[model samples]
Target: MPSISHKIQPCLWFDSQAEQAARYYTGIFPGSSISSVSLYTEAGQEIHGRPPGSVMVVAFELAGCRFTALNGGPIFKFTEAVSLIINCDNQDEIDYYWHHLGEGGDPAAQQCGWLKDKYGLSWQIVPAVISDMMRDTESGKAQRVMTALLRMRKIDFAELQRAYRG
Candidate 1:
């Protein structure tokens, strides 16, 4: 068998909603899809001779990244230690995703930018110029932008630029 190149896979554990979540994610993002799904069966010896046919796993992709959702019976849950950062070009894009992803989610109060979805998934909705502002070598401009961003949950590009000017 040929060895596959290295790829990052985010393994997600769900009680039984892996498929539903996968479809929801694919719908929310462009260029996203759920590739495949595999179910489980009691092919081997069971705890008490139980029959097979339980959902074992679901493998899919979201925004070009592969993820595996396992039906592990709710032993674990998701946390904020890991999150997806989306860099947006405008408020419309930010609002669209923020609203969609946050359908059953939570908002972290960084208006215009940071929000935690109902699933406890943390996302950073930022503007395109943020990179330039943060990476700028000019200390004064960078400092100003940084200060402005520190106070915002949702990143506002216009305010960041105003801060950069100061």
Candidate 2:
């Protein structure tokens, strides 16, 4: 297969689990793999504080989207402000992601189909139908769908469809 290239990729910040996180993500998503890895050198020991040969960065692709994980110390942390969205085609796909990504995460953070993974990275496991429901501008179906969405942690596509019809 030809190599896939991306002009823009999201860089995830981690304290010391860049490689581990990359592996975990690749395992969860299909068509994913660790493309490359880079390690920190002793030349920047004073600034980086990490021992030489420690993992510095891992470039990975998940479901065809490229991402870079960097072990840049604990100066920054993942927040809910930015999240990756996984557009699922069915309830099975939604359930699979919710179970895997929501593992070891804060239960309270699971709302409106948004979940925090074990690595503290936020993800939105949304069904494709939600988009179609939300895009109906002529009818008030969009508002109804939003109301139904606001009431659940994990999205129920069937419920959203019912709401759209109402």
lDDT for each residue of candidate 2 in 42-155, tens digit (9 for 90 to 100): 997998999989999998989888899999999999999999999999889999999988988888899999989888899999987678889986889999999999999998
Q: How close is candidate 2 to the true structure, as a TM-score?
A: 0.94
Runs with alpha carbons beyond 4 Å of true place in candidate 2? 1-4
How far out, in Å, is residue 80 in model 1? 1.3
Say which candidate scores most in lDDT.
Answer: 2
Best by TM-score: 2
lDDT of 1 by residue, 50-138 (tens): 23566667777666677777776656877767677887888788778877987778654334467777656677778867778777765
> Residue 127 deviation, candidate 2, in Å?
0.9
Q: How does residue 141 of candidate 1 score in lDDT?
A: 85
TM-score for model 1? 0.80
In candidate 2, where is summed lDDT lowest over 10 consecutive residues?
A: 1-10
